[model samples]
Target: MNFSSDAAILYWSGSNINLNFKGSEISAILKDSDTANYYNVIIDDSIVSKIQLNTSKQTYLLASGLSYKKHKLQLFKRTEWDKGTTSFYGFETNEKTKTLPKSKSKKKKIEFYGDSITCGYGNEVQNGKDSGTGHFENNYLTYAALTARHFDSQYSCIAKSGIGIMVSWFPKIMPEVYDLINPNDPNSKWDFKKYTPDVVVINLLQNDSWIVNLPKNEEFIKKFGNQKPTEDFIIKSYENFVKSIRAKYPNTYIICALGNMDITKEGSKWPSYVSKAVVNLNDNKIYTHFFMYKNTPGHPKVNEQAAMADSLIAFINEKIKW
Candidate 1:
């Protein structure tokens, strides 16, 4: 992927991802196998980078504003399956800032996994707060994109809105919507061997609690072969999701981010019941570490997104040596 403008600062987020440049432009290359995927790149606050691919090895280039300052990068894997890997590679134009110290070996990769919040669902200006008019208007300025850009000048995003860890609230929707909406169909199957991220961040839960007219625990088990996604179910489902990712990316770092929404709070205005099931899942050893709620409103606003980017940058610095 490449930025449209040379950036004084840059930010990106994705896994099994890579980057290179030609002249004043930067290029981000997606090595993942999926024909479809999403990537977000942010430069300062004015430029938002969003990309959707229907072909393999998607590449993007940004023009102008090339700088040497430290930037943030946040990469997300929107689909539960088809999780691509990402890495950073490029030349250092400025000597003022310390670069990664050139190495011939390949760099590690990272990924962010989550639902609408991580996908920046309602973050953009929309009709009503709940109407969902901004569905196609991708917010490249979202926290995930900002965080990735801060970490490295190269990154990608694969997150989607309204997604769940086990089963999506949007019935009939598949996990690979980040790539192709019908990626599993015989006409559009996606391959996952191409891209791989060293780190994976999983953020889910809000939508899992959105099921309406949920059945009683016993009834749910009889119908769906499991509890009705109560707190325990949520934890178990998340645990399983982690296990699956681990199976695919054995050495990858996993970070589970608790959402910003207060769905678990008591007597909240939202009509849905909050699922406190996975609150304890935050401490599971399967995760490299977890970040608790920052008490920000519904999807993060611009300022809130910036703060999120800062926190993620700090987390990356502390955890990953790169």
Candidate 2:
């Protein structure tokens, strides 16, 4: 996507900022048939920005001179369909300067890894909340994106709806484990190198608990090709997932989040549980953080997303000390 604006530049000297969206597609689902649809971008509760596809590429222009210690950008797609795919990228500059600075501290990357809530699903209301079945607002107001904007950090999101730590509603899929099922092509294996997350935040398990449907008291084993994720199995799988991440980005920070979709009510407690487990395994090397549900009906509301960003910023403040 290409973004440019003739308006005055906006600037911020803060360390944390967030850019959120509602219609970002990480996994390639079938494209929705709606071609006339466009996405909306909102900054800091006002200043609406519109994104439309120009030929094969999507583009947008900003109004300029917008500044904030923490800025929020949201994107929602206006369409009559269930699902579509797109990615969002943004840049900032000072009003007096034509370009942004190229300092090391100015370049930080955060990656969000999770399921539907992270994907910003069901965030839009259409026809009094009953008319639009799968319609999403495609707003950047999601917690992950908003948190990034709050930190003024660069970001990438790798999430899908109905995915879980052990199983998923989508076929041939497993959560967080390496080389499991391939949603793109069931017969093919996934390559992790294509997209590596810097700071990984996982929020899976809602779908796992829902689909398993076993007695709440019964212990289920995660069945992968030949392996089943028993409590022990899951713990080990999480370790392996973290190991893979460390192998890829040895200096990366892994933050595992719980309770976004209430997977605790179902059966998946690994995100919360694994936070403790990984801490025990790596001690001070791996920093773990947990977030409780923000009390929204199905997912987090806008205020909840802002709160998540605040928590993250607080954590970074205590650690980075700059």
Q: Pick the candidate with the highest TM-score.
A: 2
Off by over 4 Å in 1: 1-108, 126-131, 173-190, 212-227, 263-285, 288-297
Candidate 1 residue 143 Cα shift, in angstroms, is 2.1
Model 2 earns a TM-score of: 0.61
Per-candidate TM vs. native?
0.55, 0.61
Model 2 weakest lDDT span, ten residues long: 7-16
Q: Pick the candidate with the highest lDDT.
A: 2
**Which runs of model 2 end up more than 4 angstroms from their true locations?**
1-38, 41-47, 50-82, 85-106, 126-135, 172-198, 214-229, 264-272, 320-322
Taking every candidate in turn, the Cα RMSD to the unseen true structure, in Å, is 9.6, 9.5
Question: Model 2, residue 213: displacement in angstroms?
Answer: 3.3
lDDT of 1 at 243: 62
lDDT per residue for candidate 1 within 1-322, as digits (tens), equals 2223431111222332222322333445444444334555544333345655434434555334566444433233322233332323333333343333322333545566666666555565443243233333344556665666565433445555666555554442324343332323334433445656766666665665554235543333343564454545545665666666666666657666655665434543221211223244343334333344546545655555566677777876776655
Q: Residue 247 error for model 1, in Å?
A: 1.0
